[model samples]
Target chain A: MSLITPEFGLLFWQTLIFLLLLLLLAKFAWKPILGSLKEREDSIDNALKMAQQAKEEMQNLKAGNEKLLADARKERDQMLKEGQAMAAQFVEQAKTTASAEAGRITQQAREAIQQEKNAALAEVKNTAAQLSVDIAERLLRRELADPTAQQKLVDEYLKDVKLN
Target chain B: MKRLLTLLLCLCTFVGFAAEPAESGEKGGAFNPGEIILHHVADSHEWHWFSTDNGNFVTYLPIIAYQPGKGVAAFSSEKVAEGKTYGNFKLEDEKLVAIDGSKVYDFSITKNVAALAMSSLLLVFIFSSVAKSYRSRVGQAPSGLQSLLEPFIVFIRDEVGKKSIGPKYERYMPYLLTVFFFIWFNNLLGLTPGAANLSGNIAVTMALAVVTLLITLFSANKNYWGHIFAPPGVPWPLYIIMVPVELIGVLVKPFSLMIRLFANITAGHIIILSFISLIFIFRSAATGLISVPFGLFISLLELLVSILQAYIFTLLTAMYIGGAVEEHHHEEEHGHGEDFGTAEQRAGGSNVAHLNRPDVATH
Candidate 1:
């Protein structure tokens, strides 16, 4: 190495130049650059905000869908209950009408039987009276015809009849 | 006009005092080019007496001596007198050697280095305070330091981290922020007088570059290695040729980072010093007067560059980290035939017989 080293003249000048260049950049260039960076940051914030909003909207839509589904289920259940009640009511009405019709048919059947019995009874009474009248007529006729003969026959029959 | 006249009077006095010819036998009072450069750039710790408080309490500014052989030396202007025994001062072996009877001392001061250290500490304090503010307000809008740092934080997150490193970038944010702030703070400090040449030192830049290199090497995934070695779709011969080149590329990346920072910073300093040196070189009072305006203009320009260099350095570092940590994906052809038959056939004896049979099946 040389006894007298070269002074840092070059280094000093270089450093000064670099510093001046830096100052220029700070004044003129940095504003635009930093501004761009800030813009980028703002955009990122907006994106995050948008994402949060979308998530909230999705949650709201899900809740709404669930509510709609629940309402539809409730309506279906109500319709089902009404339909069941109507069906039960129709069944009860049909049962009552069927029972009433059966009662009427049974009464009619009993009346028909009673009428037939009454008719038969009336015929039997008429027949019995007619038969008795006919027999009485024949017997009287026989007695009248035999009266002259009967006096002689009676005298003979009287001796055969006991006096008690 | 009065300020200007006073400034002119001062310049005339300084020139007259500095340019006085030496004794006939001694060399003329001419400063060497090397001495001139060192006087401007080197650190000094001595207290120069400047009158500010009407000479009640003298203000002291550091003055660096333009030692011929020695790099730079600190001498108190207050202590300097006209031929007052010149005691305890010795130039030995081209270095400023001081001998106080039996004790020897080197006239070097650590004040500039301390200033640089203190500047770094200040950066730490400011950033930490900003971070604390952010933490305290969980959901509220940012204010004060939070407002200032929030923009930078988000920019790094979205532009540097997200765009460069993609989704899995949160883990690297701390390192990026630290690097960005550290470099930026150091660069700004270097612009101040009597501060350590942190970024200008090649060793410091090398250390930073090494950190980036280590991170890149260790964090590199299998895909990165695969790309370097085999390089998808590249012919085997070409890939063999490219492997060493790609490996060398890894080393070159950090080397470039080291050089870029070191060169840029050192160049700026040299340019500024050169402009200032013009004043002494002309020796003409008129030339020196003309140079003052130009020097002021250059000083203004250097202020802007101080921030730009910092930004450029940080951006490049981010890009390098991004490249290292990025994920790569490859798509395979859908209908390619299988290289091997079914496992059973490959394992069985009948498959061995079929393997021996040639084109008889084709006929």
Candidate 2:
């Protein structure tokens, strides 16, 4: 029972001192400490948020780079296909031109050969006639060795010319 | 964990074993363990350091008293050291009083008062320096005493203060921190030799409780009062029964707070003193072999209790404040249930875990 007893003097003094202590501490100690703590907390939260934002931005950039690479690959494939088609067309054009030119040269050579053969044939006919004429003149010269024969031939020739 | 449980089991066995003889109030030789413990724990006019065969070593403090007709009177407490009456006043059972048996108001600087003043000064000294470092070293890591105190300060702020007090925790931080360190430091000092059990004194605890009560009621908004007086869902007839219970609850909360701290600290002191008394009771110096070990173990346990009780006191204070200033209608209207606060704390059982539970066996 004595243990639970309360004295007025102790109560008064304890209340007075405790209230004074509370007032003093509330003014000086708690204000600054809590302020600094909250500031640090806010700053930490902000740093984490910024880091997350930066990570997302990096992911966006990586995706963009991949798309650009894919586009570039597609463009290169199209250009290669076009180049191959043009090369095939060039080969086809070259073959056709070469065959046409060869045909024209062959026809011209055949015409030239035909003309040369015709000229050679005409020269052969002329030679044969001259040879025959020479033969006949020689025969006549031999036969007209006598004067009477020459007169007879001349008269023959004259008579034939008059009749003509 | 098993180990801890065994230690706790041994502790409880020892405490239960100790409480028997203590409550029985038996006497051995000329020494009454109860008297020694009570005297040591109670507040007095002078500080008693120790006693020798020839004399007692004590330091006198100032005594301030007020009498109805005398207005105000101040003098050194030593004037009544020899049990002499001074100015029609004498020291009766360590209390200053008038010879006429009239009412007197005593505001003396007793031993506990001096201790309270000194501890407050110590707080100002330690924390003012810490506050200075906070200003100078913004965004940098803590150093020195600031580092040591930061964990506890942060623990109270985050675990106890913010978790329990919710969004408006900032407004109550000063009171919470002050009460925590004040109780904790006083409790630790009480464990030291030649120091009064400041927290063990009912008057001191009551003072602390009164402040808590004042803060809680004043901070309570209309919604809190509404919940108490008119309640939300109960039928009108139940309010007659419900309102009185709620009102009684308000008084019971702080009353329990006061008694909890006082009884715990006082019981610890009594148990430790009884263990020491066992040595002297057997009239054999050799009994010290057993008693001293037991005493030492209990003393070590007391060291843990010193911090635990302080934390419990502050945590309860925060909880009471939380109940008072808590915002509820928004949640009720939107069917958010009792879950409030942010995403982190809104997690399951957090509110109940923080607000309602007590860590009785904290060590």
Residues A1-164, model 1: lDDT tens digits: 21113224223422333333333333333333344444555677998999999999999999999999999999999999999999999999999999999999999999998998998888886776566556545655666577776566555545544341
lDDT of 2 by residue, A1-164 (tens): 53577667777767766676667667766777778877887799899999999999999999999999999999999999999998888888888888888888888888888888878877776776566557547757886788888778767765754674
lDDT values for all models: 0.55, 0.78
Predictions: Cα RMSD each: 17.2, 12.1
lDDT tens digits, residue span B247-280, model 2:
9999999999899999999999888888888876
Which one wins on DockQ? 2
List TM-score per model, in order: 0.48, 0.76
Docking class of 2: acceptable
Worst 10 residues of 1 chain B by lDDT: B331-340
Task: Give the best candidate by lDDT.
Answer: 2
**Predicted complexes: DockQ each:** 0.02, 0.42
